[model samples]
Target: MARSTGAVGPSGCAATLTEPGAFGGSLGYAQKLSDDDPALPFTPGVDHGYLGVGLDVLGNCFGDWEHRGNGCETTSPAGTAFRIPAPGANMVTLRGPGDGTTGYCFLTATTSNFSTTGPWPSTLPGQLQGPTTSLPAGVTPAAVPSTYKFGFAASTGLFTDVHLIRNVSVHPAAALPQLNLVKQVSAASDVPLPLTPGQQVPYEYVVTNSGNTTLTDVNVTDDRVTGICCPGTTLTSGQTMTCTGTYTVTEADGLAGSVTNTALAHGTTPGGTMVDSPPSEVTLPVQRGPGLRLEKTVDEDRVYRAGDEVSYTYTVTNTGPTELTGIGVTDDRVDGITCQATTLAPGASTTCTGTYTVTQQDAERGNVINIAFARGQSGATTVESPPDTARVDVVTNRPALRIEKSVDDSRPYRVGERITYTYTVTNTGNTELSDVTVVDDRVTDVTCRATTLAPGASTTCTGTYTVTEADAVAGEITNVAVATADNGTVRSEPDQATVQVESKPCHGKDCHKPCHGKDCEPCADQRCEAY
Candidate 1:
């Protein structure tokens, strides 16, 4: 069989032979296209052979082949195939654009025919091809072809062979980082009502790498919390990292009624490009401090008598948004008063009681005064209830009477001599006195002007009495009187009056006769004379 060589064109182009009937069995010339070409079953014109037989034979052939004596004139021309070897997955890693750097990639294309003009054009998407370069003979020996002079005509000759191609693709790798943040009350893990000062809160941030490339120097930041950094310095595709931070609640937070926090993620690609994730934010509601109230009352009436027992009641209530603890009650006047509930929930109330006994001092003062206090704690703050007071009036009984008695005679009295006695009664008690009367043991027919007497009132009466002979002999007359009030319910000590009777002084004529005249005879020393 006769052997002939075919002319080679640039990679990605079809190779053909112009000589016809070079192979004895064929009546027409054939042209073969690359298998990688999208247009298949290409129709040939009148000067060309049938479709399937021409291109199919050479399209499936690899390396170099020499035809024996089979009457085949020319061999198939070489074709180029493109591929990426370094990054087998067709992906590359790069730093962010901020780094002012770029990522490198290598692409290679192999040819079936040998030629000095090597490498090939590439249609890879989003990539630009670099200058063609040669590979060592040991690297691709099949791509190196043996060159010999082949004559298409007596005066025409050309050089052709298969070529091994290699080219690089330059591009910026993608750098993308995503961030999310969440905030919650550490105690409840939810929005806590009535959140006061000194309460602990927690914040969480999650960072993810969603780009095709790896990220370096990843960092996280929060508006409320500090020291937010990822655990890893570098993150591959679809990798995620989480960080946590804590914050203490403050009075300002409670007053604001809400707390807001924001988180942001930053990273750099190998290409020195700076990238940032969208800011994520979370807001939680805060509750105010507890409100407390107190009310004090008494079971008895406002007025109470001495030696009476009084019961005092105290009520404590919580009216704020949160619960209160360490609740207690106290009264200035009442002792042993305690609240049984140690904790009070919002809009809840509890009651306690204490007892007090009335004393004479209280009665004298006319009223009893007391104050009650209630207190509780909400978070780190202490809350107090408005003070309450209870007043009571006390009463005491008082009834008294007094009397005085006197006799009309001031000189010595004889038997059968008439005398007048007088008596007075007074009520010195706080209340009215009824059935008031006076009695004199030594006098008869003594009565008071009035029977009933009001406080600070007085009554008087008189009676006639005769001096007794025995009283004259004794030289004195005494009368005792006493007063009674409220129908003898109360009595006063006795009052007394006395009259002194002396022996009558004698005149010169009659020694036993009493001095009857104002200028009665007087016993003189020696020159005494009767008048």
Candidate 2:
């Protein structure tokens, strides 16, 4: 039998056996031949043997061998033969069946054999004979041959053809570290459409380690804000961390119409190499100017009498992209209403109050209407609120009246004497009285200079009457008067005055004489000269 020899490469390398010869030379396998013949000569009376590979050294050959095929007429193994590289010392052993017994050969070489040159060691290191082995002081398993193969044959109870082989090389691991960062800005609260100054905005920085290596001492920072420190000092591959930052809006930000921020992340690799993530950025919009709105309301919508007090409330609001200052409120038809809040923030409101006394003119008009206005200043601009209006209805009250009548003359009145009667009308109710008239039952042509009387006001009307014979005969006269207002629909209670009428008494004796006929004679005496 013949086996081939070739270079021993690294672990995981493959070698093939076609026509057999001494296979792996690096594993110290040598062929023995009689007369240098190329082909194997089989004797019919002999039993052929199987060929196998082992990892061992000299007389200390150990472990089960990987059999390649049944021997004799050369059988081929499936796939390529391979060697598994371990953490420490490694060697090769060649085995074959010889005359009902097993024969072995061992070889040793340096762990790493990039180039094939070999005078294989005959004895295995004591370390290779044990269940576990450690490499020589200066050798590393990662740099060693990963695969090896050897072949040998036995015939007639004697071992013969042997060979060793190896395959390709493998390298050590590499170092790599990478980082990525992104930033975003958002409003902290319900902000007006346009951004406002003095508002708080939040910034977020997302840091990610996307490389195969772990990163240490990771830190994040923002251009617009400071003290943006990450939670963790280290980041692993495919892991992420978040950092926070904040900024207060400024006047310049508002004027520019927007605010911008940038963020960056940095970290160090295990190998002590520092790296930075790509810069990230975010932008927030600023609001334009201050806006104002006004609303007006009243405590009572309707008043039943003049001089009634009413309260008005005015609400002023700042509906703005920014804060408003020096806000003021005014009403076109009302007095004393104002704004309680001099400054207002976006989406904030405040109220103030005023009072008005219902006037007679207001009651006459039936309704009191008021309109309010609000104004504010934002930056250098002034803003006005939309007009708001409120209305109060006035109800009219009827006037009440009382009347008094009197006469200037005493109870006894002679015929043809003049008597004067007077009437007084007073308004006791809440409203004014107009078109007032006073009438006396005993006389005509009575008039008053004052025709209109206000609440709690009075008017005097006088008339004169001449006493008549009928009045004298009765010895008393009575007169009645009435006070009426507003076309006589309202009237005061009727009042009356009575006066007595009598003839003058006859003086001395003349007063006692009674003449029976017309034209009686004059008395001769002084007291009765007509007798």
Candidate 3:
């Protein structure tokens, strides 16, 4: 057998051999393109001593091949080669660019009118164009190659071997990274201060965040300590959410004080960022300080007579942390008044007293006397009682008197006859009379005998009646009487009386006159008529 090569150009016909055939016998191989090549026939035949074949590849046999003397004595090129007389059965193979170390991949091409410029290696099937491209899983062929080289279409050369041609290529891929943020948290500071009972005090809080990562949505929540709460809840960045809250103080054990106005401020970060600050925190402190108290004892209402003594009392205490100095109580209320007290200390107490007298003459009931108390220095600080007062009531003083007297208006008496009269005095006024005296005015014909009369008491006086011979004088004598009580009030009515005097007969003559109608006569009956 002899070997020869033949050549074919872009058109269908084979080119005539200009050089002589070097080897003997018809050594021919037809166009054996991959199944994807449009120029390769699905069903091939032999014509003009050239033959076609279809081949399936299991490995990279194309890169490793050699020629033997029985076929052609030729140095091998770096591609697949074969014998000139084609076998009854054959396989065609196609490939894409890849690494030899990793694995192998196959490509599929479409069958269509073979044109070099035709669309090939497309995503669709049946169109003819370029070389085969790699087919991933489930992919159909794109376009097929238009002109594939047939081995027989070569010149009859001494070293004749068919070379199979293929092509391959490669590229790479890309990526990106990620980012995140964290949160913050915080804790509280200290305790709070104390205030007087029923009094109020303001408290403060210091808040912060402590967590692992930077926080995104930062918010503050408040847990109100009963009876204590923040004036506002929301806070701006870096702004102190001051809780302007108050606590009303109440009495507790005097030794151990009570606590109030305790609250918590908690912070939160919204996103899932790592917490640079603590996840949870409290911003407020426990409150503590000295306690205070006040107590009063005296009742400002009282009554006392003029020149009478009145006393009042007061007590003060220190119920807190610090001591109280110069604690004092005073009442400069009424005239003739005085007050005093000393000092008080923390958790200690003291009492004081004051004395006063109602001295004014007209000081009446319900009059006010004021009193007050001080707590700091001797003369400086103090708190006063409401209506600051002491009430007073007083009594009255004066004297009064009344009197009566009786006397005889008419009297028949001798010239030296004795007579008596009496008088009485009484005190009907409210006050008792002291050092009282009574006096009687003497009559011209009568004489005064007794003098003093007690209040509601009586006294008598006597006068003398004389019968001196009244031969030359007329009939009778009259006299007047008068009396005075308290040496000032006088009582005497019609102050005089009539008196008669009759002389006894001297030398058998009648001296007493009886209702004298016509005087000095001797009455005689017919029998004893004598004149």
Backbone Cα, N, C clashes tallied per candidate: 27, 34, 48
Ranking by TM-score: 2, 1, 3
True-vs-predicted CA distance for residue 389, candidate 1, Å: 2.9
What are the RMSD figures for all models against the true structure?
Answer: 53.7, 52.3, 64.9
After superposition, candidate 2 runs with Cα above 4 Å error: 1-291, 295-393, 503-531
Lowest lDDT 10-mer window, candidate 2?
A: 71-80
What tens digits encode model 3's per-residue C-alpha lDDT throughout 421-486? 443444433233443443434333332232443333434444444444451133465544554434
Per-residue error (Å), model 1, residue 51: 99
Return the lDDT, model 2, position 118. Answer: 26
Tens digits of per-residue lDDT for model 2 on 1-531? 222123322121122332333222212222221111112221111011122333432221221112122111111111112223221124433333221111221122333332222222334445444322333343232323322333333221123535343463433243323787756553233333345677777766767797889999999877789877578889999787777777888888877878888787999999999989878776767754666767777743133458888788887777566788988877776676666788998878899788888888876544576777888888788899778767654555656778888776545888898888888888866578899888777888888868899777888888899988667546688888888899998888898888888743323434345633223322122122232
Compared with the true structure, the alpha-carbon lDDT of candidate 1 equals 0.51
lDDT for residue 414 in candidate 3, whole number 0-100: 54
Q: Order the candidates by lDDT, highest first — what do you get?
A: 2, 1, 3
Name the runs in model 1 displaced over 4 angstroms: 1-387, 390-401, 411-418, 428-434, 451-455, 468-475, 486-489, 500-531
Report the number of the highest-lDDT candidate. 2
Candidate achieving higher lDDT, 1 or 3: 1
